[model samples]
Target: MTLKHGPIKNLDMEGMTMIFAVAKPEILKTLKVGDKVTFEADRVKGRLTVVTIAKSK
Candidate 1:
């Protein structure tokens, strides 16, 4: 999945847009392009992957 998010303070990353693989692709099924979401991401097997995701309140 591709995400444009704020800096991940824990990862010491600057805010930027990027595409990442989703560990649970099914989670994306209910989302739309402009929806706000909170997700957990990580590098797995050298690929960025979204471990968990949810619609933001």
Candidate 2:
């Protein structure tokens, strides 16, 4: 999935749209297109990955 996100604090990345690998497949089940979310990401095994994610409320 391509995500357009604000600056990611932990990853030290500027806000930009990009594809991120989800660490858990179930994380995708809870989300759909256009849902706003707050998440944490990391470089896992040489891939940029979503470590934890949740719907923004």
Q: Top TM-score: which candidate number?
A: 2
Lowest summed lDDT across 10 adjacent residues in model 2 is found at 1-10
Please list the residue runs of candidate 1 whose C-alpha ends up more than 4 Å from where it truly belongs after superposition. Answer: none
- Count of clashes in candidate 2: 0
Estimate candidate 1's RMSD in Å.
1.2
Please give the CA lDDT of all the candidate structures.
0.86, 0.90
Q: Write the per-residue lDDT of candidate 1 for residues 1-57, one digit (tens) a residue.
A: 789999877567788999889887788898898899999888888887888888999
Clash totals for all models, in order? 0, 0
**Residues 1-57 of candidate 2: C-alpha lDDT, one tens digit per residue:** 678999998888999999999899888788989999988899999999998888999
User: TM-score of each candidate?
Assistant: 0.85, 0.90
Show the colliding residue pairs in model 2.
none
Cα deviation at 20, candidate 2, in Å, is: 0.3
Q: What local lDDT does model 2 show for residue 41? A: 91
At residue 29, candidate 2 shows an lDDT of 88
Index of the highest-lDDT prediction: 2
